[model samples]
Target: MDDRRLTDWMEGYVRAWNSNDPADIQALFTEDAVYLTEPYAEPWQGRNAIVRGWLEIKDEPGQTTFRWEPLAVEGDLHLVQGRTEYRIDPPRSYRNLWAIRLDGDGRCFEFTEWWMKEPLPE
Candidate 1:
């Protein structure tokens, strides 16, 4: 797949996330895609689990926005950095490291996100 298409697909995925629609979020992945968060947490496997995981975040309090910056692209692999803002009165921000693998047909097969957020120092 071309980098342009991959970037566009990634943008669509982020749009789905921003929409907070569980089905839209799950549409980014393949049927058996694996999504791992951190190390020990049981990785969400398959589309159903991914949809459930996203449902937990849908309709969460506060305004959330995401900004994606492409880092590197090699063949079907894409690395990107993302900034997420949880716009509470105090506002919270998260930095995310994302590795995305795209299939030959331009669909994503796996996406792993690593992120860190420190509480707004109260």
Candidate 2:
């Protein structure tokens, strides 16, 4: 997909993240989508499961800030490099890479997130 399409999807994703609304989360993916929180971990398959899984570990609204830039695009696959910084006390941060595959309808059919925590200060 193109940068604009991916950006729109990313915006929707962040909006969903902030809202923790099932409909918002559900809209970002397709019916048969597969969502992998890590490369080698079990996936939340299908829209219903994805919604449930996301809610189970949902982060509170305004709990974090996120920024991202496009990394690459190969046909339907898009990659993004991002940073997430939590706003709570004893703050935390992470670097992220998201590999997203979208269907013709512009909804993600497969999404895998790779992330690493930043080392805390002494």
Candidate 3:
């Protein structure tokens, strides 16, 4: 994908996360997409499953802040590194690495992420 397309997609991802809207989430993926929350876990397959899985762990709208930068793009795959900050009682942050593969229509067919919680300061 081109840089503009990638930027638009990432922005949409952040919007979808904050909105937690089922339609927003569904719009990002294909009907038979696969979403892997972690490397070792079973992926949430298909749009319906993906929507259900996302809602199960859904964050409240406007509860988190996210920043992401494109790392690379090769063929249909796009790699990105991101940081997410949660504004809870005790704030928390996570660093994320994502590998996303987009179909011809710009919907993701496969997505995987590795997220690490930031250690508290001493």
Compared with the true structure, all predictions reach lDDT values of: 0.79, 0.94, 0.90
All candidates: CA RMSD (Å): 2.6, 1.4, 1.3
In terms of lDDT, the best-performing candidate is 2
Candidate achieving higher TM-score, 1 or 3:
3
lDDT of 1 by residue, 42-119 (tens): 888888888888777564633787888888889878998888888777888899998888877666778788999956
Better of 1 and 2 by lDDT: 2
For model 2, how does the per-residue alpha-carbon lDDT over 1-122 read when each residue is reduced to its tens digit? Answer: 34777988999999999999999999999999999997677899999999999999999999999999998999999999999999888999999999999877789999999999999989
Q: Which lDDT tens digits does candidate 3 get at residues 7-118? A: 7778778888988898999999999999999878899999999999999999999889998888999988999999999999788999999999988778899999999999
TM-score per model over all chains? 0.84, 0.95, 0.95
For model 3 the TM-score comes to 0.95
* Clash-forming residue pairs, model 1: none
Candidate 2 Cα errors over 4 Å, as ranges? none
Candidate achieving higher lDDT, 1 or 3? 3
- For candidate 3, list the clashing residue pairs, or say none: none
**Which ranking of candidates, highest lDDT first?**
2, 3, 1
